[model samples]
Target: MNFVGYYRLPPVRGVFFSPAQEERLLLLGCQEVFSDRCLAGGVVRSGLDRALTALEPGGVLAVPSLHALAGAMVDLLDVVRRLRALNLDLVVVQPPIDTRSDAGFFEACQILAT
Candidate 1:
């Protein structure tokens, strides 16, 4: 399956996050994975918009970690809502959450609570 992915790694950390994430996605049998790494909430990422537009119907957005979406829960929630409207599945790898199921919904709520 084709996937568009998004992630963020703090610049201060020096270590890159995308390499590991790309490896994971590739191992998952993803034919293609488009990703962008940015500082969370630092700026509007145009790559996300392009990725969303590139997504085929029923395609997935593989986010290796949920926190990469935003630093705030509200921002994350907004992103989730918008992605849902586009009928794209969000695959959050670390916690193994998929927004396509009830369990995922509950897990998401749990994450938002923290």
Candidate 2:
């Protein structure tokens, strides 16, 4: 199982996760982690784009949380859309999100929207 991690940091310097979370992801077998630093509420993410492009079909993407994907709901939805289009599965550590199932996918989108 090929797994990848995605995360973001607020442009100003904010830490969203502790070492424990990273350790957990490593235990879950995430070999690569891609992170982006962006201003609050900004949608343009180069790291995200690169991660998406690097991921092959049926790959798994691990995120710490929905909020980490984007500060704005629109950007969050866009990220989800791109992930869906790529046929990549999303595993959000917090809130236990998995986009492999229909309900899970819907719930992930809902969580990001709200």
Q: Give me the candidate number with maximum TM-score.
A: 2
Q: Can you write out model 2's per-residue Cα lDDT over 1-114, one digit (the tens) per residue?
A: 358877776666555444655676677678867777776666457767777777889988888887766677787787877777787888887778777754566566868767
Candidate 1 lDDT trough over 10 residues, lowest sum: 35-44
Off by over 4 Å in 2: 13-24, 40-44, 101-103, 107-114
Model 1's TM-score against the true structure: 0.71
Rate residue 59 of model 1 by lDDT: 79
- Kindly report which residue pairs in candidate 2 clash with one another: none
Model 1, runs deviating above 4 Å: 13-17, 37-41, 103-114
Alpha carbon lDDT at 6, candidate 1: 70
**Residue-level error in angstroms, candidate 1, position 97:** 0.7
